[model samples]
Target: MREGAVRWLSPAGFFTMRWWEWGPEDGAPVVCVHGLTRSGRDFDALARHLAGAGRRVICPDLPGRGASDWLPDPMLYQPAVYIAALSHLLARLDGPVDWVGTSLGGICGMGIAAMAGHPIRRMVLNDVGAFVPKKAMARIRDYLGTEPVFRDIPALEAHLRAVHAPFGALSDAEWRHLAETSARPAEGGIALHYDPAIAAPIRAAEAQALDMQGLWEKVRIPVLLIRGAESDLLLPETAAAMAAEPHVTLAEVAGAGHAPALMDAAQIALVAEFLAQ
Candidate 1:
């Protein structure tokens, strides 16, 4: 549950970003990144598993989420800015590190891991691949559109359950944990932790194509890809396309939708075993 903040520079300006750490600080580094609008706390349950095994696991709250500073310019929420900030964080770490990224985080991992001599040693992409079509973006937008302020935690939890049904079968306690961790005290009540403006760019990119073939091809390290069996974002064709490539292994998570919550033992083990290798 320990946390640290780093001052990173983006084109827009300097911002303070936060990261949570677990396990022995000197152990091999493992960075876990969450999806769009989600914070580093999303990895708490999984972090415990990796940490207990003696890995130095770090989960970063990308700017605008969790305890990090929100970008003044919402347009800067694009991947390039995020990559730049994360690059700064990696530079500070000063060594090779493994990466576990879900959705948007996976895309960021791809961008960095593809570099000539980036610090990333291995990567795990959850429910995302080299290509994300317009259709999937639209669905993501539908959920991202809701940013209501709730009178109580229970109501907020209920709202999250419906919108994030795609996270796949999180238990009652897990849902409550998510709600509590993902909220901020608003003027009237509690609201989702992330800045509402974070969704604007996503909405604006509904028609844009997200193709990372060049980056994916450049990533030479071993990669473990996890996709929800019922994922709409990562289509059967897209998963097949990535699995056929070099340095990539695909694992299907049954009973999940757009993404697997990774809270359950099975899902956590899927990630732990891959990084343990």
Candidate 2:
């Protein structure tokens, strides 16, 4: 894998967004974005697979996660800032690139893809839809504010295993890999890498329904919506409506809840085939 960085401007100033590049530089580009609180490294397994098939896969670390810099103003950690930063990153890439997003990343992609002059040619939104239930959003907000430190990697892995159980039947090795990538040195022990302050907006915001159906209707490009069979964020009716729309295909994965870890062969294949088409 090759490492690259792009400077993106936000309200607080320009922050460098780091991305891992794979496959031939001239190959068709595919940008894979991770979920809230997840780093770009989460796409490693999927990236390798797409790269092997001669696709140039670019996975970016959203600000406050992975190797990206934390925002000076914690309140600036909302979706607008993320969308602006990613737009800059997209500007530096070849036009009409394919996008694969999970959770928060999916929202960002949907926002951009709905624009009249969007650079994305096709999209894959995994485990997130037009609207997220208040219950699920609340659960994420509650957990996101914590700065839990683990005495060891194993302990950290265990915590992730429980919290991310919805990511579906990940292997023991996969759990270990996630723990290793997500941990950072804390005052006394290792903790999840993202800034706890990133949750400030979520905690401070008024509770309300998140509706994005308007934006979804604006995206005319082909879209593949991957929903976890048991996902709370993307309910059955919403998924069905999204599927009913033009150029949208819904695929539900069994044995997963909030999101499916695209690391597995079956999950990765779903994304690969759609993007290939």
Candidate 3:
């Protein structure tokens, strides 16, 4: 894989969007987008598998997370801003792209794919839908505003496991990789890579309801919806409603809640198969 950055100007100032590129440059493009508070590295396993199968995979670290530059104003961290950044990234690509997005990333993909002349040829929404439960939204908002300090990598890893237990059963190596990539050296020991202020917009918009039915209906390309069986965020009823659409297909990952970390062979195979179709 190769790492690179794309510079662009936002209302706050100029910033660089970092990304990890894999597979042949001339091959078909597949863009993998991470959830809120996560980075591009989350897709390492999936990207490699797709790359090996002859696809150009691009995983981007959204602004305020991972290697991307933090915004000057926290309010600028909303979905519109993210969509704009994605637009900039896609403009540089050769042709249409197959998209894989998780949680917040999936929301952004819906907006883009609904556009009149979007370049998204296919889409995979990991564990999100138009209507997110109020309880789950509240749970996410409660923790997003705080920045915790850890004594070491091990300590940080423990915290991640506790908060993200819903990600299901990840191996020791997968947990370690997640911890290493999600953190950075801090004054005390280590801290999460993302900007805590990015939570401001989420908190502010908590009261507002999300209605993406119109957008979903507008999408002309094929879509795959992968849901964690025990997820509190994407309810089974919602998934059923989404699947009612002729263009959408649904898959569930057992032993997972809220979201599934696509690290296991089975999980990766599901994505690979969908994208291949």
Candidate 4:
């Protein structure tokens, strides 16, 4: 794995966005973006799998999460901010790239793919859609801004298993990996890697409704929608509606709830097949 950073200047100031790379430099580029509160490391297993299949996989830690710099103004933590950062990343790449995005990441991909002449040639949206259920939104809001301390790694892992149980039944090793990557050194113990201030704009945005149907209808490229069978965020009906689009392909992961981790071999294979098309 190779680690690098891109220098980007936002309206607030300058910051460095970090990313993990795999596979050959000349291989077709595939960008994987993580969900809110999760870092790019979440895609470690999936990135390695795709890279091994002869694709250059780039996993970026969205600002405020993982090794990326946090924003001074929490208000800058919106989708527009993310879209701007993604544009910079695409500019750094060789050509149009395949995108795999989860939750907030999926929404950002949608915004980019909807643009004319966007660099995204194909996209895989994991557990997200034009219409997100308010119940799921409230559930995400419940923990987005919290700064909780863990006495030990085990404690942190336990908490993560509880909160993210919807990710489905992951192996003990997988749980530990998630816990390790999700934590950062803090006073007395450790805290989540992401900045809690990111929740500020999210909370404010919740006061209004998000209507992305117009944007969704504008995307011209092929899209693969990977939905958790029991997802509260991207409901079954929403997934069905999205599949009605000519360019959309839908896959529902059984046993998963709000989202599928995409760590298993089967899930990775499914994603690889879609991108190959």
lDDT of 2 at 10: 90
TM-score of each: 0.97, 0.98, 0.97, 0.97
**What tens digits encode model 1's per-residue C-alpha lDDT throughout 1-277?**
6898899998788999999999998989999999997899999999999999999999999988999999999888889998988998898889989999999999999999888889998899999998887878777777775788899999999998987888898899999999999989998999999988888887776455577887788888899999999898888898998899777899999988878888999999988998888
Candidate 3 has its poorest 10 consecutive residues by lDDT at 205-214
Q: Give the alpha carbon lDDT tens digit for every residue of 35-129 in model 2.
A: 98898889999999999999999999999988888899999998889999899888898487999999999999999998888889889999898
Which regions in candidate 1 have their CA more than 4 angstroms from the true location?
none
Query: Positional deviation of 203 in candidate 1, in angstroms?
Result: 2.5
* After superposition, candidate 2 runs with Cα above 4 Å error: none
In model 1, pairs of residues that clash are none
Best by TM-score: 2
Ordered by lDDT, highest first, the candidates read 2, 3, 4, 1
Error of 4 at 137 (Å): 1.4
TM-score of model 2 (CA atoms) = 0.98
Q: In every candidate, how many clashes are there? A: 0, 0, 1, 0
Which is superior by lDDT, 1 or 2? 2
Question: Deviation in angstroms for 32 in model 4?
Answer: 0.1
Question: Which ten contiguous residues of candidate 1 have the minimum total lDDT?
Answer: 202-211
